[model samples]
Target: MRIGIAGWFGSDNLGDEILLHTLVSCVRSVDESASFVVFSPNPDRVAALHRVDAERMPTLRARGAVGRQGTAQRAIRDCDILFLGPGTVFQERSPNLPWPGTLPLFARIVGMARLARTPVAPVGVGVREGGTPAGRRLLRVIGAASVAIGVRDQRSGSYFGARAQVIGDVAYALPIPDTQPAAAVEEAAGSARPTFALSMRPLAPDTEAGLLLSIGGCLDRLQADGWTGDFLPMAFGQDAQGEDDRDIYRRAFGNVLGLAGNPLNDREGTTLAGALDGWLTALAGYRLVIGTRLHAAVMAVALGVPTVAIAYERKVHDAFVDLGLGRFVVGPDVDAETLHRTATAAAGSPAEFREAAGRVARQGRIAREFVTATLKGLG
Candidate 1:
């Protein structure tokens, strides 16, 4: 079987990579002979990491110009099925970066797939704040074209009405490593102070400053309670124009331990599985995670660690709400005192939080079942 997967992938974003990994795994479990071709911004990187054939997704410059004869369009035309998403690909809510053409690009991709008579399935996806006009139209087309549409949250399902199935995020079903590095385990066990992991991203200047200040205050309070901090960068952008999470972390907490720096020197001959294992190992050590990035919190929760989600975007809150961990989510307008208190409270209720996360992980298996059943029908 030949399948084509498309999403906001290959951007050095750990979360998206993890989602891709999980989606591929789920599909392979049901169809061992399945072959995949991916559409990504960084095709070479996707090919290197996921061991799949890849083509660059149609960019804004190529918008409305992709014909049936175009390389990417031809590949999709030949594929038996197309899988679109596990990310907030439909959202136009980014304040710093505008994605005016993204939805239209997706519409064209799906339109091309439909023209070729290939089945399209949108899985583990979400819509942010009802999205733009193009995005809403894309959703309508997806509903009309797809064999099944599986949204990651309730709010996202509302966009498609009866067409959408409420499947949990694919990341929750990702396979966890049985063991971490011995040294990592020992360090975490030996540390006298409680460890915390932090994930931050780019935002509006004023909002960014406020978030940093709030985080700094939280760190101060955590330090007073004898907790140490580790800044995790889930995504590192290419070139100067893109936003880098590492830079954001450095600006917020200067010179702190950066887990994203690959402190364990884990990149030597690294594969996707190895990188994911290394990240999971590092995250397993944290007593708490304060995350602005959705996947950072997802990974933390999957590892059974308590997390405080900073909901700069609706998807963040939506994911937490799906996990039944909504109490841990705070908005950008949240004050430092509220953030600190929430973090402290979440940290204190570790058992309950972990249990809730585990339940969500269990629920995520429904996504795999949905895929399997859909594929079986296709066969």
Candidate 2:
């Protein structure tokens, strides 16, 4: 059997790559004979970065409908099954980025699969807030896909109608090497020096630029409270000069707190596994996490660190709420004083925080089983 996978990939971001690897690996575990045709923005880059032996399927530039039916049609025709899995596809958080013509892309791919007698599925997918008219239209079309649909959030599951199943984020199910000792994780948290981690993406093209100013101000307050700032950029899109944001935050710390530079730029790291391993290990000492990326915050939970989620959209809020800790989430426009107060309160309960982390670890194991079983059922 052959499988075709689609979504945001080939970027330097370790989180997206890990989710892709986990979904692909789970599918293959159930059917070892299956091979993959991955639809990626840049095939050669993805191949080199992940070392994945997948057939390179082209996608359009990050603009609206530029090459919609071009490469996806071909991939759909050739595969036994095609999947549009996880990523920020359903959310238009960055106004600068173009929205995919969802109806056309889905129709063409699903039509091709129908003509070729192939099955289609949407797995580990979630639809967050869609503010624009085009965005909401795309959400409706994605909801109507006549294939197996597994949504990560309760909101996205409701959007998918009757056939949809509510599962946790796919990254929760992704495998990590057992390198870090449990005792080491506990000891680091107990050190209690008030370490804070932040992972954020740039706002959409249409978003107000001053949003960055707000974030900078919040980080500055964090510094005054004697918090050490750690920054992780999840997906480095086309922007090269974006490290300035980190610099601004680091300077806000007034030299007392140190900054660990971009984890992706580390020369020694090659594979997604290596990058994530290095990044998580480096942050093992964090006491509080202020993360924008869903998986970055999930990584903190996986490593027994308590997190404060900067909820830019629904999925961010939903993920933490489902984990039994909504108090850690705050709005995108949150003020510096609010951020400082929230972090201070969150950091005080280290013991309870550790227990919550344990729950996430257990849930992660169950999430892995869900994906494995779903793949077997598909086969």
lDDT of each: 0.79, 0.64
- Each model's backbone clash number: 0, 5
**Per-residue lDDT of model 2, residues 1-379, tens digit only:** 6678777676656667777877776776677777777777666556666555454333343554446455556656777677777665455543444454343444455566667666666677776465566755555555565456777776777655777776677777655545454346546557534567777665543332444555667777777766656666566552323423344444443353455644456445366555666666766557777777777787777666767888766778887888877888887778767876777777775665667666676765655666565555665
The candidate that achieves the highest TM-score relative to the unseen native structure: 1
Q: Which residue runs of candidate 2 sit more than 4 Å off their true CA positions?
A: 53-74, 91-94, 98-103, 131-145, 176-194, 204-225, 238-263, 266-269, 362-367
Mind giving the per-residue lDDT tens digits that candidate 1 earns over 121-163? 8889877783676667667877778899998888888776687
Best prediction by lDDT: 1
Model 1 whole-model lDDT (C-alpha atoms): 0.79
Which residue pairs show backbone clashes in model 2? 94-204, 95-204, 95-205, 96-204, 96-205
TM-score of each: 0.91, 0.80
